[model samples]
Target chain A: TLLENPEGLKMGGERRKITILTSDLRGFTALSERLPPEEVVKILNFYLGYMADTITAYQGTIDEFMGDGILVLFGAPTVREDDPRRAIACAIAMQQAMTPVNEKMEEWGLPLLEMGIGINTGEVVVGNIGSEKRTKYGIVGSQVNLTYRIEGYTIGGQILVSETTLQAAGDEIKINGQKEVSPKGVKKPITIYDIGGIGGEYNLFLETNEEEFVVLPEPLP
Target chain B: TLLENPEGLKMGGERRKITILTSDLRGFTALSERLPPEEVVKILNFYLGYMADTITAYQGTIDEFMGDGILVLFGAPTVREDDPRRAIACAIAMQQAMTPVNEKMEEWGLPLLEMGIGINTGEVVVGNIGSEKRTKYGIVGSQVNLTYRIEGYTIGGQILVSETTLQAAGDEIKINGQKEVSPKGVKKPITIYDIGGIGGEYNLFLETNEEEFVVLPEPLP
Candidate 1:
């Protein structure tokens, strides 16, 4: 479960650098309107089950499940040197996992689901929050909210990463496109990269500061 | 508490047409980053307390609190003929209440806070969600998500309302400006009205299918 409290973890919050990932289903509200409540639960269960498995597999911590959206943290309760790379790899795997999940949806005669994911690496206060009666082990920071805004800019099946994340992940992840966006409340425009894949033999493009791009073929003989 | 369930409310879900209001404190996450955890909690408590009081004063139900954001429902557990109008009035009151809140923040030597509110009226599935051990009396629907999207377009101290809300509010409220927005997942462009005040003397503009506008003076003297 996303709310699990690991043993020996401090109840007091700690500030740490972590990569936060937020993903939400596209058109889910519209889709849910047409289905019965029980059906909505089934779809959410199947979808979240697959996603939770993928996150755990990558050693990422599931933060909270907000209706059809999921907020996840990488490098919490424990830190990994390759957390950024792990986050990107985990995102790709989740995208790949969507295929089977969609296949099941088709069998059930339900509308196919698409997701938009946003990842950002930054410092956040993470640990138990709230009063004694009701406490939640979660993360809070501007980066957490930025991850949501970045996810907002995406459509179905798109994974967007902030410049900080791209720099941390290095050349291991390939990029399909890039854009600068000024999300509300943020002081300045941020450069975001549309992730393609992890070290794939795909065509890459080089762009000049003037916005001109040259396509470069990979694995050229 | 936003999650409080009043007496006699059903644990089972029900369908109802309620006005949903979502508001978020602009730039709060950035401001919190510079403050300590205890200070952050203090600010949230102060802000949310004022908001919760305003919502309850107007007979609205607080659904959930999302970090710096709050989702509220009016016409739930009971229906009111003037729920939409009450919601708009409540939003205006909240904006007005911000002045005192900001004053207090200034006295505390903290950054002043601004909020953006979005209201939408539509049918939603409401009642207990989750297992018996952990059920929440909340709302679910596309309209709930649309309210969030509408809130996204607002800056600080702005209240944006959907067409449904406008229709329900009728001539009881005055609007200062209007714009058409195509929120993500929404099929087409929607005309959103920027609310000015309730039953106030203000200039209003009328638009036609061709996007032609005619300005009319307040009270049509």
Candidate 2:
């Protein structure tokens, strides 16, 4: 059902404020190498099915699937005032959904898979992006690329958000930590926040904060 | 045109021995962050245009464009005996074409852009990848993911190939150096060859070879 939307195939493009989220399965390449092709597909399908369901439930659009990576967009063709909030919530849900997905993998004798998510909110050109014969609804802009760079910094099970998303998402979202990263191609170092969860149901694991409390012995008395 | 072919949209997929080439434009994100949206699109179009031309010239298919990255395939739709060689040769040509591309960027008062290419040869599932409403010809497998991991190790202007690709490409392709990288997901360390050029016309700059010459000084007595 994710790829069955007929309205997404219409021609032309437009510029709008949208939130883009990119998620990549960590260590999938190595895991797939050791397994049979059908098994790999089965495992990937099991993982991606949960992701797709969660994303669609939040009204997010599945732009495309890049093998073990996925590109998703919010606030395209349909816009909501809380698109950024929805994007963050959807990401949180996806992260939590991995529990059952991995459980299924365990039953199938497949290794557990981890995912890193990066979300950014900005203006982008969204529409059907190919020629007359074939085209798919997609969003493109520097923000999309930025989301990718931000995602590259994340490890397994971490959700990272750009400053713009943090600002727009309001104060309800908790921050586990923040990183000032100068990713390749950006002139300035942008601060990215590690999202802890929204509301009371989810728990926050501050993995990046361990180094901050490192205590050195009193100056070699 | 690259996106105009109707034959690439059929349903179902096939497993074939195709050469996958993944290239990413280095620092384009930082560069785009400093420029206007229109200007960023202009520069990207300029760079990707040259890459498309070279790939088409080599009879390769432009599978998909991942923002600043590209996933190309050879021996798809139609297979060729020299698909591996064509991939390597196309990579070399793409590296060579950067000079002109940089010149245009310089003329436009923009900084130079660098690209890293990774080529791999193996069996992958290639064919229409999505539902019938919207399907694109693409390749997916461990080899495809391995190509991405291999490309991750490359710097700007460098071409890295897997052992499989190097073996199938024959001796006409010159190697600058080789590295044993244990990329995540792979159980064992794999050797990746840094390709310098193809044929006698191109030069091989052994950037990876410099470290091998480290000489230990005489032990202090």
Candidate 3:
């Protein structure tokens, strides 16, 4: 029984809209290929576990992990009136938290890693789902897609966010406006911005490795 | 830049686990052949709008909407300790909700719509994806693949889920333990179950639609 019910379409009382942040690891394929499967799994566990912990530390929910990545949602399951601000804060914390994580990866003699994060805010339909057999809780909307688009813009070690997110985040976040680019399926070109750093002191533009490139994108086809 | 950075896998994080549901209109190809493009789009919109509305109400994220179907995720952008149960509950709701939706379609002289939903739950990597220029939020993994496999079992108005999901849903869900079926790429046969009606209202086995028949999967080469 996995079809829609009429009554269920009515919104659940008390649910509020919020911001979503979807983050993925950079260079994971190559890294996974470099290590054995077990090692790859181990490395992923170590890194992802740490990131989830950090995100949750800021009262964010680790919605789901899709392998080498995490879908982190703010002001959901638990709503914070300042969810936009909280999302920006979480992005900052995530960037800062990666330092020690990268250090550990280096210590393990594994290749150091980088990540890209995308954030968006909008009204989304949120609820529980699954069949008569299982159910899950999540959010849905073009906002989710927009968040993914922002993340897609991130190179390793960079945080990308949409203009809506930037406005919602307010002065709490430090961001440098990037270029406007069109994403597939979406008609309008979305402006991408770099999370310069968060909490004022932490800088996301730092390069941990000597050869880190400022831009991690491939040449256009 | 759009082809470079992917989310979640680059940095370490906890294992992101959740359920994925892939549902498509059954006999859509035949339906398409019989209908004009505009009418088809209209019908699809009506049907998908209903489905999408119900899915969002249940807290499930409508991750992507293709031509005639939607891919939904439970436990993303938000998660509960009881996500599996939530997913199953949502599935039941979906089936239960279909009655009135179909009635509306019939009123519009649109053919009754049927869907096949496959649900599977397990760990995956979720995150923001894309390259240096753009990014999007999404999920990836074998769990995602397995969920699609479960969807393949259904013909029309059927729900198929992996055993893992059943166990997770526990006593809340009632299933008719369909015989284990072999799916491609996996060594062991996946234990599947036919869904009975949800909330004790309907049973899948009792239904006898003259049009219903076993969906013959493509022959293996």
Query: For each candidate, C-alpha RMSD in Å?
Result: 11.3, 12.3, 13.7
lDDT of 3 by residue, B13-57 (tens): 234678888887776645654555445544544566567667777
In angstroms, the error of model 3 at B220 is 48
Model 2: interface root-mean-square deviation in Å? 9.7
TM-scores for every predicted model: 0.68, 0.67, 0.52
What are the per-residue Cα lDDT tens digits for candidate 2 across B59-116? 9888887656788898998999989988898898888778888888787888899999
How much lDDT does candidate 3 score? 0.66
lDDT of 2 by residue, A1-221 (tens): 11223233334446689999999887776665566655655555556667877888889988887767888888887999988888898999898888887877787677888999999999886655432233346556678878999999999989999999989976568888898999875789999999977763334233344556779789975
Cα interface RMSD of each candidate: 9.2, 9.7, 11.4
lDDT of 1 by residue, A97-151 (tens): 7888898889888889998899999998775643232345656688888899999
The digit string of per-residue lDDT tens for model 1 on B1-221 reads 11122212234556679999999898787777888865676566566667777777888887666667777888987899989988898898888778777887897888889899999999887655432223456567888888999998898988999999999986757787899999977899999988877873322222222454565578844
- Residue B216's lDDT within candidate 1 is 59
**What's the lDDT for residue A110 in model 2?**
71
lDDT of 3 by residue, A1-221 (tens): 12344334332322346788888778675455445545565565666666766786778887666657678778778887777777777777777778877877787788888888888887565455323333345554456766776788788777777777778765646665588989855778878787765554333343345446476689889
Q: Which rank order by lDDT, best down to worst?
A: 1, 2, 3
**For candidate 3, what is the recovered fraction of reference interface contacts?**
0.03
Instruction: Specify the CAPRI tier of model 2.
Output: incorrect
